[model samples]
Target: MSDAEAARALAEGHLVILPTETVYGLAADAGNAVAVAAIFEAKGRPRFNPLIAHVADAVQAEAIAVFDARARALAEAFWPGPLTIVAPVRDRDRVCDLARAGLDSVAVRVPGHARARAVIAAFGGPVVAPSANRSGRPSPTTFADAVEETGAFAAAALDGGDCAVGVESTVVSVLDGRVSLLRPGSVTREEIEAVVGPLDRDGEGHRSPGRMALHYAPDAPVRIDVVEPRPDEILLGFGPGVGALRWSLSPSGDLREAAANLFRRLREADREQPAGIAVSPIPAQGLGEAINDRLRRAAGFVG
Candidate 1:
């Protein structure tokens, strides 16, 4: 769909499925309570889990959210990329309470995708767009998958091709002069720490999204850190030495590539109707941390 059409649909208080660098999102005007409500109802998402508002740039993001020094530094470094900053709301009345889950903070980001920026710029306001899928389902990395999940409910679907990151944005909360990592995503913890010294690593008292266990799952069960695949299981391999009839996340052992392919690979494995999916071990460093975070959630890990 065109940007004008998508913006128009959003202005009218309707859901719009649009692409981002990370994943396709179910978008609506963040200031419109009814529009935000449509997003929750369409995705079957629980009201407690808040949504991330996508803005055109850092200036626009600061208008709704109160960004401290750390928040400003992070936004200056990672705006227009796969990084979300949950900060205290500057004006509660400007942002619909539903979008913030009735909290004083709002999860906001400036997406890196050109199409996403175009739509936001055209729409001329903040738009809250969570991953465009039913709650707990694997996030849609492609337009076709988005159509299957939200096509019926969304007023328009803006196809901007496959998502490059193929995962959610790294979520960090900057509240009370502290930076805490909430959910890992395409951006690494190391990258964030480089900009803002050490991270608090605590998510308590924050309403950041993607904190739930059993999220990003498919129809079949998933087993992670598997070195050997059982006969009945579908093998999702990484690096090398993978046998035939397996989907390799990154044969070159590149964590960035592996992170980009993680969700799509899992979705492909689930499509095979396997008894379970056996995922090869992915080292926990850099982007691998985000990859493992998604894997653990897909495997139904809690805590």
Candidate 2:
């Protein structure tokens, strides 16, 4: 279906597979109860796990939540980008609570993709979206992945090509004047620290969506390969190997590129339905941490 039509469907409480700078999101009108519920149903996602609300601008974001001066500053610095900041839902709780699973806090961001902005502007409300796929599967970077999960619910999917950034947004929650890294994503801890200063570093054990030790996982068992590909395993972040399927993170070793391609590659391997998948080891630091986080999740760690 057309993007405008998809936007219309979403505004009318239907699901649409929409593009984001990071990945395709299973999007719904965040202001519509039935629409938001459909997103949960589409992914078989637990109610307690919240979705990130997307907007076109700061004004739109502020209308849905209470964003103090700090938030405003960050919005000015990062909006039209891949950065999700947790804020009080306030008036938007009426519509967003269903997306947030009754949490007082709402995850919100203004994606950098032009298509995403276009869709949000067309709908004229918060669009609470999560990665478009079954809850435990690797998030989709293309329309093909969305169709695999729910073709009926995704009446329309905007073809914005593949997502530019394959990883999720960096999520930070400012608490008692301290910034906490709720999720390590496209934006790194170092980058965030540069902007927000030394973080409180919640360091896991936090009740947050992406924080679950196990998240962004596929149903197939995952094993990380530090040396070479194993015969029976589908190798990810490498190239095709004789006995094993090869997938490489980034031949150039670009963390951001690897992050962008991470899920797409994992999902490709999953389509093969190998008994298990083995990931090649990425650097333990930098975006490698972000990449490893997703691998660990696929290996069965909860956020």
Candidate 3:
């Protein structure tokens, strides 16, 4: 569908599937309590887990969430990209309490996808969009996977091709004059620290999305940092040494390329109905941190 159609659906308090740089999102009007509730119902998402309110720009983001100096600097450096800032809610009416999960703070971001921005601009309001998949499932990074996952619940679906950043946005909390890394994504901790100095490793009291111990998982079991795959297992290789049947995230060990292909490969491996999925070791640096985060969650090894 077109952006105008998607915006119209959102304005009428209906769910819409929108494509973003990170992944396809199931979007709904944030201010509409009933509409926001539908998202939880459709995705089987827990109400306590808050949704991320996607805006067109930093100006719109500031109107909904209180942006401190750190938040502003991060926004100036990373707006229109895969970075979400959780801050105190400035406009409660614009983002309903349900969307914020009854918290006083809201997680908001300006998506880098132009079509997504266009839809938000046409809708003329903030929209709560979470990964377009069932709760705890791997987020859909392609239009086909998104439609298959939750298209029945949406009033319209906009296809913006494949997502560039396969993982979700890097989420950070800029509360109490301190910046804490809530969730890592394509934007690394190093990048955020460069703009806002050191980040507190502890993210207590900062409710961010996608924090479940077991999330972004596939049907088959996942084993991370595996050097070899079992006979019945499907191996997702990283750099080199990939066998004929194995899938390589990046033959050259490019973290960015691996991030872009992470979910898609997981989905493919799951389709094979393997006994388990074995993943090659990925370095814990830059985009690899985010990739490893998702992998750990997929393997149900995260705390």
The candidate that wins on lDDT is 3
TM-score of predicted model 3? Answer: 0.98
What is candidate 2's lDDT per residue for 217-251, written digit by digit as tens?
A: 87678887445656777766543332333466666
Ranking by TM-score: 3, 1, 2
Strongest candidate by TM-score? 3
Off by over 4 Å in 2: 203-207, 237-246
> What Cα-based lDDT does every candidate model obtain?
0.88, 0.76, 0.92
**Each prediction's RMSD to truth:** 1.3, 2.6, 1.1
TM-score of model 1 vs. true structure: 0.97
lDDT of 2: 0.76
Candidate 3 clashing pairs, residues 3+ apart or interchain: none
Please give the clash total of every predicted structure, in order.
Answer: 0, 15, 0
Q: How well does model 3 score by local distance difference test?
A: 0.92
Candidate 2 local Cα displacement, residue 55, angstroms: 0.6
Query: In model 3, how large is the Cα lDDT of residue 110?
Result: 97
lDDT of 3 by residue, 1-303 (tens): 788888998999999999999999999999999999999999999899999999999989989999889899999999899999999999999999999999999999999999999999999989999999999999999999999999999999999999998999999999887899999999899999999999997785339898888889999999999887899999899886664434889888899989999999999999999899999999998999899999999999763
